[model samples]
Target: MNITLVLFLIVVGITLVITGWAARRTRTTVQFWAAGRGIKGWQNGLAIAGDYMSAASFLGIAGLIAFNGYDGFMYSVGWLVAYLTVLFLIAEPMRNTGKYTLADVLSYRMSPIPVRSAAAFSTVAVSASYMMAQMIGAGSLIKILIPSLDTTLKPWFNWTILGTKLDPSITLVGVLMMIYVIAGGMVATTWVQIVKAVMLMGGAILLSFLVLLHFGFNLGGFFNAIAGVKDSKTGLNFTQPGILYTYGKTQVWGVDKALLENVSLGMALILGTAGLPHILMRFFTVPDAKAARQSVAWAMGLIGSFYIMTTFLGFGAATLVGKSNICATVAPKCTPNSNLAAPRLAEYLGNSFFGTGGGEFLLAFIAAVAFATILAVVAGLTLAASGAFSHDFYVNVIRTHLLHGHVSEREQVLVARITAALVGLLSIWLAARVGATANAAALVAGVAFVIASAANLPAILFTLFWKRFNTWGAVASLVGGSLVTIWLVAIGPGWSAPRPGWAPNRSLRRDPVSTRGERPAPLPYIFLVSQRDLVGLIALDVACLLAAAMMLRAWRRRRTRPPLVAAIFVVVLAAVATVLVLLGVTYSLVVGPTFIVALLVIMYTARYERRVTQR
Candidate 1:
C-alpha cells in the first residue's frame, strides 16, 4: 500500500509491457543480441549512458561528495572523463569488429576456442562483481521505497529460503532483472535503459534545481551553507579534501594516500569504460562505426552533463540533508547509509512543496527511479554475461569446436535467456546471504573496475593496434592479467576481511596498524596496491598500453617511433617511479615485480604472435 511500492509497480508494469512488445520482434540473433544493429545515434547514446550510469552513480557519488567533498568528486571526474578513452579508442574499433559480445572482437583473428573462453570468463567475472555491488545497493533502497516491508509485512517478507534469508525486496530485484533480460533480450534491455536514463537524469536535474532554488539560486550561498554544518564523531568540512582521505589513521596510509587513491580510481574509470563488456556491447547496437562514434559523443555529452549536476546534488545533500542526518545519528534519522542521501533530499524537497503527502509521493518517485536504475543496469550486466556464455562459449567455442556445429538463432536466444535467469538467481543468492554488505559490495565494484582496466583493457589495446598481438599474447593478457588482478584483490583488505562484520571497526581502517601502510608479511601487495593505489596503477597501465600501441602504430606505419609517444611513456613511467619512491623501497620491491614480469611475458610472446597482414 505504500506509495513507493505503487510507483515501483507502475514502473515495473510499463517495462514488462515494453519487454513483451520487444519479444515479438526479437526473433533474429542480431535483434536479440544487438538490436539488429539499427539503433539511432542519439537513442543508442542514451542507452549507453543509461547502461553505464548505474545505481552506484545514482546516489553513491552524490552521497560521497555530500560527506567527503573534493575526494568524492574524484569518482565523478574520473567516470566522466573516462568516455574520452572510450570515444578515442574503443567505440569505432569495437563496432567494426564485434558482432554481439566483446569476445567477438578479441577472437576476430585468434583461434576462437581459448581466446573467447578467456574473454568470456573475464566478462562474466567483471559483470558479476559489478552486479553484486548494485544488488547490495538495491537491497538497501528497499526499506525506503516500501517503508512497509520492514514493519507491516515483516513476517511474510522475511524468511529463510534455501539456507539464505530471503527478503522479498532482494528477491524482487533479481526477479525484475531476470524479467527484463529474459523477456526482451537486448531490445528490451535497450528500451529499459533508455527509460531509466531519462528518469534518472530528470530526477537529478529536478533535485539540483530545487536545491539551488532554496539558496536563491546563488552558488556561493549554497557553498557557505554546506561549509557551515558540522558533525562531532567526524566533523566534515564539505570545502575540504583531507576529511575523509587524509584524516586520522588514513594520513599514515601515505603522505598523499588520498591523492594516489583518487588518481588510481580515476585510472580505473578511464580505462575500465573502454573495457567494460556491456558498454562495448552498446557500440554494436548502432548501425556502423559512424553511428558508434556519434553515439559515444552523445553519451559523453549526456554523461558529462549528469556528472556536472552531481556537484549540486552532492553539495545539496550536505547543505540540505547533513551527514549526521544521513548516518551515525540517534532517533528519527534517515537510514544510516550515505547512499540514501539523494532520496532523503528528495523527501525533504517534497515536504517543502506539499507537506507530508507531497514528501511521501516524491520519496516514492525517487525510490522508484533508484530501482529502475538497478533494473536497467543489472539487465545490461546479465546480457553481457549471457552473451559471453551463449555466443562466445556455447556457440563459438563449444558448439563449433566439439560438436562441429553452430547454434541456431533461436537456440542462441534461448541460451541467452536461460543464462540471464541463472546469473540473476546467483546475484540474488549472493545479495541475500550478505547481511551488511555495502562496504564489501563497493569493494567488489572496485575489483571489477580494476580487472577491467588491468586485465580486459590491456587485452583490448593489444588486440586492436598491436599487429604482433597473437593468440598467445591474447590468452596471456586476458587470463594472466585477470588472475593477477584477482590475486591482488584477494590479498587486499576486501576479500580477507571477515564476511559477517561491516562496521568501521571490523573493516579495513584508519586504525593504527593499517595507517602505518606497511605490508603484513602475508599480504604481498597490501601496501603496493592497497585499494586506491591499485586504482592509480590500473589507469597507469591503461595509459602505458595505449602508449605502447601508439608507439607500435607509429613505428610500423610512419617508419619510426613517434617522439610524442615515447615522451608519454617516459612521463608516465617517471610519475610512477616518483610514486614508488614516495612509498619507499619496500613497497616498490613488493609490487614492482608485476609490471616487469608482465612486460617480459609480452615481449617473449610477441615472437609467436605473427602480425595479421589482412587486418
Candidate 2:
C-alpha cells in the first residue's frame, strides 16, 4: 500500500471511530450543538487553536512564506493579533448573552425577526466562503500527495457523475465532512479538532526543529538565510514587502497601493475573528463566560506559538527546498502555486535524515495531518452555517412567523442535521468550480475575512457597545455590508480575468487577428466572487454606509414628499445599477458603495417619516 494512503486511512479510521462514539451522546439539542457545555477550558482552547490554525495557517501560510518571503509572514502577524479582539470584546459577552449562535445575542436588544434573519444570512455567507478555501486547499494537497492517482489510476477515480466530472479529492473531502457533522455533531467535531491540532502542532514543531538543526541551531544563520533568499523566476529578494501586494505601479490617495492593501488586509485579519461564526460558536461549547475567557487565553498561547513557528517552516522551505523544486512546469515534483511547499520540505528533510523511504513516510505523515486539519475545519464551518440557518432563521424567524409557537428540540436537531448535509453538498460543488491554481491563504483572507469584517463585525461591535444601536442599524449593516462586499468581489480581478485557454500564444502576440485562439474576459459579475480586492473595498463600503446613515438622519425632521421621492429614485437606480453591474454595463467600484448608501437612505426615510406623520 502507498504510505500516503495508509497514513490517510489511519487518520480517517480514528476520526470515524470518534464520530460513532459522539453520535450516541448527540441526542439532545444541547449535546448536538454545544456538547452539553461540558468542555473544559483547556480542551476548548485546544479546539479553538485547531479551528483557527486550519489549512490556511499550515499549508497556505507556509506556501505564502516560501513564495513571497517576508510579505507572506504578514498573514501570521495579522491572525495572531486578531485574538485580542476575541478575548477582550467577544468571547465572554457572547457566551453570556447568546445560546446557540451569534444571532442569539444580536436579537437580545432588538427585534428578533429582522435581526436574526440578517444575522443568519451573514453567518452562512461567511462560513461558506471560508469553507471554500479549506476545500480548495484539501483538493490541491490530495492531488500532490497521491500523485499516482493522476497517472496510474486516473480513470478509476476521476469519472463523470450526472454530466459533471467529479474531482475525486473534493468529493471525498465533502463526503467525509458531511458524515462527521450529520452523524457526530459538535461532540465529534470538537474531538476531531483537538486531535488535528495536536498533530498539526507536532508536525510544525518538528519541521521547525529540523530546519533549525540544518543551521546548527544558529538563529543568526536562519535570519541571514531569509534575508538573502531570492526567487528563481522573478529574481526578487525574499526580505521585501512589495512582491505580492505591489504588483502594479498604481497609487491610491498619495500612498503606495501596497501600503493601502496591507492596511486593509491587516484590518480584516484583526477584526474578522471576533465575528467568525465558527470561532464564536466555540465559546458556547464552554460552560460559562469564565470558561470562555479561559479558552481564549489557552487558544492565544497555542495559536501564538504555532504562528511564530511558521517562520521556520516558510523560510526553511524557501532556502532549503528551493522555489524551483517546490513549483515547476515539469514532472517528478510538479506542485502548483507552492501549495505543497510544507510537505515537499518535509520530504526533503526526511530524505536527508532518514533516506528516501523515510522521506516518503514523513511526507505522508505531514500530508495526513494537513488533511486532518482541513477535515476538522470544514466540519466546524458546516456546523456553524447549518446552526445559523436551522436555529436562527428556520426556527426563530420562519417557524415563529408560521407556526407561531415553539419548535420541539428533536425537530430542531433534525433540521440542523439535514441542513448540514445540504450545506456540505453545495459547498463541495462550489469549491470544485474554483480553479486548482488558487492560493488557499489568499482565498481565505480575501473572501472570508472581507465578508466577516464587512457584514458581521460592525453589527457585533454596535450590538455590544453602542447605546443607540437598534434593529434597523443591525439589519442595514448585515444586509448592506454583505451585498456590497460580494459585489466588489464579483467584479474584482480573479473572476473578471479572461477564462481558461484564452491566453495569446507568444508567437501570435504581434498580430491581433492571429491571436484568434485567445478569448475575451468574462462578463463582470457573471461568475462567482473571488479572493482578491478586499483591503480598500471593505473600508470604502463601511465608510459609505455609516456616512449615509448619519447624513440621512439629519433630514429626519424634514421628511416630506421630496425626500421620500428621492429615496425611491435612489433605490430604483440602485436596482438598475446592480443589474447593469452584473451584465458588465457598469463597474462595481462605481456602484458597489451605493448599495449601502441606498439601503440606509431608505431606512432613514421609513423611520423618521413615520414618526413625523405620527406627530
Q: RMSD of each candidate? A: 9.5, 7.4
Top-TM-score candidate index: 2
Task: For candidate 2, write residues 93-196 as lDDT tens digits.
Answer: 89998898999989999989889999999999899888888887677767877665345445655766455666678778889999999999999999999999
Question: Tens digits of per-residue lDDT for model 1 on 165-275?
Answer: 876777777887898788788899999999999999999889889888889998888878877865444565667666656644444334555566666778888888888
User: Top model by lDDT, which number?
Assistant: 2
Span of ten consecutive residues with least summed lDDT in model 1? 605-614
Question: What value does the lDDT take at residue 535 in candidate 2?
Answer: 34
The regions of model 2 sitting more than 4 angstroms off are 148-163, 231-236, 246-249, 328-336, 439-441, 499-591, 603-615
lDDT of each: 0.78, 0.81
Query: Cα deviation in Å at residue 297, candidate 1?
Result: 1.3
- Candidate 2, residue 445: the lDDT equals 50
Clashes of each: 2, 0
Give the per-residue Cα lDDT of candidate 1 at 480.
74
**Candidate 1: misplaced stretches above 4 Å?**
149-162, 230-236, 247-255, 327-335, 496-615
